[model samples]
Target: MATDVTVPTDLWEGDLEAVITNWLASDGQAVKQGALLAEIMVEKSQFEVTAPADGTLTITQAADAIVRKGDTIGRIG
Candidate 1:
C-alpha cells in the first residue's frame, strides 16, 4: 500500500498558494517516516514537508510547482 504525502491543510492560514521550492528526497529514494522530504514557500515563509511513512518516495509534483493546501505532492510505498 502507498501513503499519500500531502501539504497539510492547516499549514498556513489563507487562500494563497505555495510553490514547491526544493525536494530533499529524490524520487525512488527510501525514506523513514517523519523525514524531511521537501520544502515549500508561501511568500517569504518556508515550510518543510515530511514523509508520512517509511517507503520509497515517488514525486507526483515537481519542484517549482504551485500547490494548494491538502495537495498530494508525492506517495510512499
Candidate 2:
C-alpha cells in the first residue's frame, strides 16, 4: 500500500488548503525517511514536507498546484 502526504496539521492550523511550490524529488523517486520530498506553501508561507519512511515516492500533485490539507500530494511504497 501507499501513503498520502497530507498537509501537516501545524502547517495549516486546521486549514485544508495549500499550494505546492516545488518538489525536491521527482516522481517515483526513491527517498529515505526524513528526506525533503517537496516544498509546500500554505497560509502564505512555505514549508518542507519530509518523507515519513523510506520508499519510492510517486507524486500526485504537480508544482504550483493547489491541494487540500488532506489531499493526496503523493505516495510512498
Candidate 3:
C-alpha cells in the first residue's frame, strides 16, 4: 500500500503558499513515520514535513517547488 505525504494545513496561519526548500531524504529512500522528509519556507519562516508512514519515499514535488496547504508532496509505499 502507498500513503500520500501531505503538507499540513495547520503549519501556519493564512492560506500562504510555501516553497519546498529541501528534501531530507531522496526518492526511493526508506523512511519511518514521523521522520523529517522535507523543509518548506513561507516568506522568512520555515517548517519541516515528516513522513506519514513507514515506507519507501517517492517524491512528487521536488525542491524549490511552490506548494499549498494539504498538497501531496510525495508518497510512501
Stretches of candidate 3 off by over 4 Å are none
- Per-model clash counts, in order, read 0, 1, 0
Clashing residue pairs, backbone N/CA/C < 3 A, model 2: 16-69
Instruction: Estimate, for each residue in 1-77, the C-alpha lDDT of model 1 and write its tens digit.
Output: 99999998888898889999999999999999999999999999999999999999999999999999999999999
Give model 3's TM-score versus the native structure: 0.98
lDDT of 2: 0.82
RMSD of 2: 1.6
lDDT of 3 by residue, 1-77 (tens): 99999999998999999999999999999999999999999998999999989999999999999999999999999
lDDT of 3: 0.97
TM-scores of all candidate predictions against the true structure:
0.97, 0.84, 0.98
Q: Assess each prediction's global lDDT (C-alpha) against the native.
A: 0.96, 0.82, 0.97
Worst 10 residues of 1 by lDDT: 7-16
What ranges in model 2 sit over 4 Å off? 14-16
Indicate whether candidate 1 or candidate 3 has the larger TM-score.
3
Error of 1 at 75 (Å): 0.4
Cα error, residue 10 of model 3, in Å, equals 0.5
lDDT of 3 at 23: 98
